[model samples]
Target: MFSPRACEGDTNPVLIPFLLAAAAAAAAPPAAMRLDYFHTGDAREERFALDAVVREGPWPGPPDRRLDDTGLGRYQFEVRDAKSGEPLYSRGFASIYGEWETTPEARDRARGFQESVRFPEPEALVTVTIKKRDARGVFQPAWSVTVDPAGPAVDRRPPPAIKVWAVMKNGEPADKVDLLLLGDGYTVAEMDKWHRDAKRLADTLFAVSPFREHRARFNVWAADTPSEESGVSRPSDGVYRRTALGTTYDAFGSERY
Candidate 1:
């Protein structure tokens, strides 16, 4: 299991804990919940298995925006009230396996990828369903599982030794779009550089037209992992290095995907 970010290390950090505490005391919003699972198979077939359910932190997204009606991505997941079958939360997301299955490699061998879905923690039991696009692009149920919000199976452990800071703060997270900046290939010595890189990335993002115009509607957050290496693995160039977060280039034969 990967250690959580919002991880340890920074002291007296601003905003996050405040929101968590407020949500705990009042009916502000539900805490964020994450579902981790293994997606396995090849181009011809597929399978899913539950891995773990974790309490990440306070939910940052808008409570009212529960359903993703855009019908995007190759896959979609829905969380519903177990008894009434009322859809509580839903989202469409693209996965690494979604692309991996289309590759020629999938035709030769089977592969598995660890994937996760995050939703607001429900009050009681909720049935989660994952839908997949068919040949005609119609979304259909592929997997379903039931999760209890107060179940002992939920992992409530503290995060790892990491540092979190806000690059840009715009009101509360629920009222704004929250952007998370996570580094994979960076060592303890490169923390300052990572900080600079995060700011630069945020700047780059806001330099665009829409994001620049609506800057106040977004909150940018950054986390430092302090891996053993300074650069991610580039398997295409015959270079490999181990890091805390395993991110690499040459994915799906793309250099910078």
Candidate 2:
């Protein structure tokens, strides 16, 4: 139930193919474990509190590439075996909080953002450590928590009941890069249009270079929850509508976000 919104640029058609190729190469990945939490902070300091942990379907990437050697984000999370201390998995990613903390608003008041981190489901107890970049661009421990995969509190409920169809199927999900296109603000009556647009976006992605050459190496899927009303909320224009994705313009005081 705690589905995190795909970040900006995640739905970018051109970026999908490349991201799939790089991130997912596993032949038989494990189920995905999602750790949802509240990231609260001001410009001076921040804190993290556990919200819920859930199983989020089969893991879609290569198992061997669990450690994220790519230092690309403002934050990094690692999952380590509790008994052995050996790292089991790790990934670097950015959150909305990581961006908001830099804004001027953060200087005056603390803000909280719902954030989530996904990794392969571990077989045993593990310690999850979250790290943030320091002023010197070095990663420093921010928070750590222990998680037992089989703990009663871990939510094992199946992912939301929504239709997921492949726009393009290349190979087994574990062997190929998988990209999910989530549609927002589309109405039930516009479901067909959502499908068409999803495919059109995929076509646009494939038309671009390098993706054009390796189209067969990627798989694209689309899922949507129709909104009660069409289009997204734009309070600036005095047009407000609730949508499944809860997406709106003027994020962080910027219209483009």
Which predicted model would earn the best lDDT? 1
lDDT of each prediction vs. the true structure?
Answer: 0.90, 0.89
Pairing residues by index, what is the TM-score of model 1? Answer: 0.85
Report clash pairs, candidate 1. Answer: none
Colliding residue pairs in candidate 2: 26-62
Q: Would you estimate the TM-scores of all the predictions?
A: 0.85, 0.84
Instruction: Give the alpha carbon lDDT tens digit for every residue of 1-257 in model 1.
Output: 33455356674356578878988788666789999999999999999999999998778788778999998999999999999999999999998899899899999999899999999999999999999999899999999999998999999997666678999998888898888999888888998898999999999999999899999999999988888877998998998978988888998777766
RMSD of 1: 10.9
- Candidate 1 backbone clash number: 0
